[model samples]
Target: MTLKSFALAAAMGLLASTAWAETKIGMITTLSGGGAGLGIDVRDGFMLAIAQSGRDDIEVVIEDDQRKPDIAVQLTDKMIQSEKVDILTGIIWSNLAMAVVPAATAQGKFYLSPNAGPSALAGRGCHENYFNVAWQNDNLHEAAGAYANTVGHANSFILAPNYPAGKDALTGYKRFYEGELAGELYTELGQTDYAAEIAQIRASGADSVFFFLPGGMGISFLKQYADSGVDLPVIGPAFSFDQGILQAVGPAALGVVNTSQWNKDLDNPTNAAFVESFAAEYGRLPSLYASQGFDTANLLLSALEVADVSDADAFRDALRAANFDSTRGDFEFGPNHHPVQDIYAREVVQEGDVFTNRLIGVALTDRADAYAADCKM
Candidate 1:
């Protein structure tokens, strides 16, 4: 062959290789509203992992959903149709996840959930292209229920927002609680005032309270509940009391028991490095949400090393293998594409003015999602 022909052929091959090497990712998370703290942590943790990976081949497009389902749907459409993202991740709220995931997966794009594992996506609606790196919505609450049972809390007041995830949270608590409800209540989404709820809790004579409010709602409730002077013990999912908002919740959150899949003090090399590096980078401790984001990014990077995103089957299998070292140890995906890992009871404690959770004990071991059986996929 002529030298010019050889050079042209080589250039064409290089162009194809470069195109194949690039993996475009889109991140839609709540970054400007009530739940912004959770989304910020997830985005930061995810970016931290991507930076650590030092892979120039991955390009990311990030958008703020504003905690609105309509905005999330719009962003998903733009990302898939215009941005041409190979993967989508970093949604904080279940409502937003529900709006965006099915559509994204239906269009043959991968959706890796760093947070928000609504039971709907875990059960009969499960999609082959959807992977939840976080626990199912019910996992932590179920653990909370188990903890309540262990602590002999026979009659508990339970409350969450009137939403799909909120209902799932209360239902999960009842599944393993083996107790009578003092009162079951649902608050408006993003409701800050808890005066009426506090009054009811005080009047109900309940020995304990289980709440599933996240982000700003949790902070408000904790502060109000403390000021109300109700001596009832509080139990909730770690989302309410995670490191991101613990300082905001202040000492009011102290001694509260919560359930989580990952804690900063999990005693693993990956977790140690993640907690230290995350604190150094962000000037605060990492939350369970942050840990999930970090893990999700690493999971994608791991899959990228072995499989090209263009091959959906290969990429899905690579993700299911879960090759990365998780901050939450013993992490693996269940048949329903949700995590099967241990959930622990965590008690909020103040360590030099910063509130954080200490691992108290394991609430559930090697636990898989309850909806896995319902997942036909």
Candidate 2:
């Protein structure tokens, strides 16, 4: 054989040997304590997709950050340094997302965000290594703010936790609702009791109240809001009153209005199949959180099907180009590394045997986020 043929044969042998090797996916999420609802949903969704795709080339290493940013950094460091994972995925909070994504990207590993899109990463700080399968931090809230304006909800009260996501949510709400301001309250992060705030809310005399709180926070707030004897209409983003909260808040979430990019009620074949299969696998209705997680995994699989994930440049180019069809009806990358999609106004309603928030109105069909123009990336 020629010398060139011998070299080619040796390279092909190495590729064949590593073809069945485990592809480690380091998933850092809030798996313990109060934040487990969303994390569990995301985990189930990812596993469901993996099983359906029938690709055994991946092994997922799931860890719970427990909603602590410090623990997230530590666990992610271990995953990157010790396990030598091929990719990193799943984060439930913005702070944790910000803390871990940079490390993953700096090492030239792909970081897929199933949830949590911090505001800073959407602008000039946007990195090519990071890809969000969820909407931007403010994207859903911005849609809620627009709906507030459309419904003539002027002089509204706003409440959010005193943290990065809380600040971003309120900022997003005010971006489009150009009406008279009533009052804004920033509470401590993870505070369970909303009685004090409920009292304050009663006295604020605002026409409507808008809030952004996820997981346990939403559960507590929705229950308290219903019991507080406040008659005003309550509005929030989907994350604040999602399936996770519905299980906790029970009937308290009824009649609440919120906005989201995807809901199970969407009339599309992709979503229908996903919801049915997810329910059969997990024995529960899938939330948008789960849908996004599944979509993130599917998105990676799509790019991998076309190009080698080990080729950093090729994978990044394909993801940045948004060349895959998302289960959310459409897919397009905005300038800020976020997605431009439809935003639906959903209301908490009981559909058949399950209690859920279904889309009642189309808030913004094919909407672009407010910060896209400001983003220079």
Candidate 3:
């Protein structure tokens, strides 16, 4: 063989050498503790997609981060060194992502985010190996702000947790609301009791309320708010109204408006198949996180079909091409490798015995993250 041909053969051999070209993925996500529902949904959705694709060449090692940053950091180390995973994904919290993503990518592992798009990573901290299948941290809240104005909320009181995602949540809402601020508050992460906050909301003289609590925090706050006699309309991002926690919140979430990139009722073939397949496999209705997880898996699978992960540049290009159909419809990655898609308003409603969200209308069309401009890559 010629020298050039020999070089090409060696490169191909290296690419094909990964356990006979079987892709290994490491998923570190919160599977236990307070906000476990979100991570469980993400994991189930991703695994369901992989099963449906029938790709035995793809192997996954899943671990529970337990919603702890220190433990997440340790898992990242283990996944990269011990498991020898080619890719890492399934982080749900911005805090956990922040602790894990930078180090993981720096160590040469491609990281796909099914949830948690911290603004820091979207902008200055952005890496070519990092991709977010879910909306940016602020996309839904920015949509919520616009929707709040459309529905004639003039003076709004907003609240979120005191974490990175929480900080992004309130900022996103204020960006487009074009309304007077009646009050703004930040609560503790994983806080279950909101009696103090609800009392403040009642006395804030606000015409409307917006809160960004997710998982159990949302369940506790909504039920408490319902009994507090604070009759103002409540609006939030999909995290607060997702199917995983809505039933737990009971009737407190009904008629509440939330913003999201995907809903089950969205009209499209990709979404239809995903919704149906997810229900059949999981025996439960999927949440927005589930759709994001499914999309993340399909994105990786699409890249795997076109370019081997051993060729990082080629694989990154394939991922950027975003050839897969998303449940969100018309989805694409912005310059920062984050989703650029339509954001819709959804209203919490009851379908038979199950409580869920129904699509109301599009709040933002073809929206990208606010920090995309700051992404130098």
Candidate 4:
């Protein structure tokens, strides 16, 4: 070939490489320890959405936080300084979120929360570039409290772990429940044995019980509570009653009503497709965490379509628009960049030895976070 032709081909190749640089997304999630299931679902769902979008101009970097706050902090720094990721997402626990989110967003990088929506980030600590695709920490707990009232739970006993989300849970339950509190307890985080807690509940003289334990904590609590023969009707947020947790809890989770923003049985074209596709791809039903991850990816994809990430103002405004069709049906961002969406009451039922949740009813309609009013943004 002539020298001129070869030079032209080389010039074209360099131009192609220089243009359309793939957008980098860093995901710091719990993938190899307690609560790994939650983070795994989030990662799979996010990847599923990205795959279906068929977009070649995006790249994702994933790291396991190992359910440690320090690990999450380190991952955040590595993502920002070394990986040069433009966006960050996929954190499961509130304490880890607290350790990672503030510093990441403060650096002018966008952080989209697929889970772990702490109250501080929703209210006085709100940021322009931070978006919570999942419900606020209080959203489902508040719905559980509201549903508890309608079901004639005039006096209730509530408990949660001693973390940020746990504190948010009890506070949210009290905010909406008109009932007198029979008792309230905060267990140590990741406490496996709930014997003492159950003993207290058994003696508390409560008509009903509500808890906000997630991951293995919930499985242990439910099994022990069932064995203790506390026949009082129990209610909780969907964290404890997720598909994987329910299976581990076995019959202990049956008939327990939990509140959530999405369920496999929600009636909508979008949700129907998600459920069908997720089951086909993963060979299992999608849980609340999975749905949130799918939505988070789609939300980011939509914003990327309309505005470049380098233009922070335009991208932030696009995210505030919340242009994705969520599995929960309608979804939009409130002033605080948290979701303003409906919460549903779901009941656990067994189908051929497999445990899953079905939508019983809408617990709260168009529920906005209690902290939204406090957010100046």
Q: Is candidate 2 or candidate 3 better by TM-score?
A: 3
Predicted candidate 3 versus true structure: per-residue lDDT over 1-377, tens digit per residue = 99999999999889768576799999999999877888999999999889989999999999999999999999999999988999999999898999999999999899999999999999999999999999889999999999999999999999999977898999999999999999999999889899999898888899999999988889999999999889999999998899988988999888999999999999999999999999998899999999988999999999999999989999999999999988988979999999889999999999999999999999999999888899997
TM-score list, all predictions: 0.94, 0.92, 0.94, 0.94
Q: Model 4: residues >4 Å from true position, as ranges?
A: 1-20
How many backbone clashes are present in model 2? Answer: 0
- Per-residue lDDT tens digits of candidate 2, residues 240-274? 77776686788888888899998997888888999
Q: Taking the tens digit of each residue's C-alpha lDDT, what string does model 4 give over 1-377?
A: 99999999999998667544778899999899767999999998999899989998898999999999999999999999988899999999888998999999999999999999999999999988889999899999999999998899988999999977899999999899999989999999889999999999899899999999988899999999999988999999999999767888999889999998999888989889988998999998888899989999999999999998988999988999988888888999888999989999999999998999888998899999999888886
Which scores greater on lDDT, model 1 or model 4?
A: 1
lDDT of 1 by residue, 1-377 (tens): 99999999999999868767799999999899667888899999999999999999899899999989999999999999988789999898888898899999999999999999999999999999999999899999999999999999999999999888899999999999998899999999889999999999999989999999987889999999999989999999998888878888898998999999999999999999999999999998888888989999999999999899988899999999999999997789999999999999999999887788999999999989889999997
lDDT of every predicted structure (CA atoms): 0.92, 0.84, 0.93, 0.92
Candidate 3 Cα outliers beyond 4 Å, as residue runs? 1-18
Compute the lDDT of residue 340 as modeled in candidate 4.
88
The 10 consecutive residues of candidate 2 with the worst lDDT sum are 368-377
Of candidate 1, the 10-residue stretch with the lowest lDDT total is 15-24
Tell me model 4's lDDT, rounded to 2 decimals.
0.92
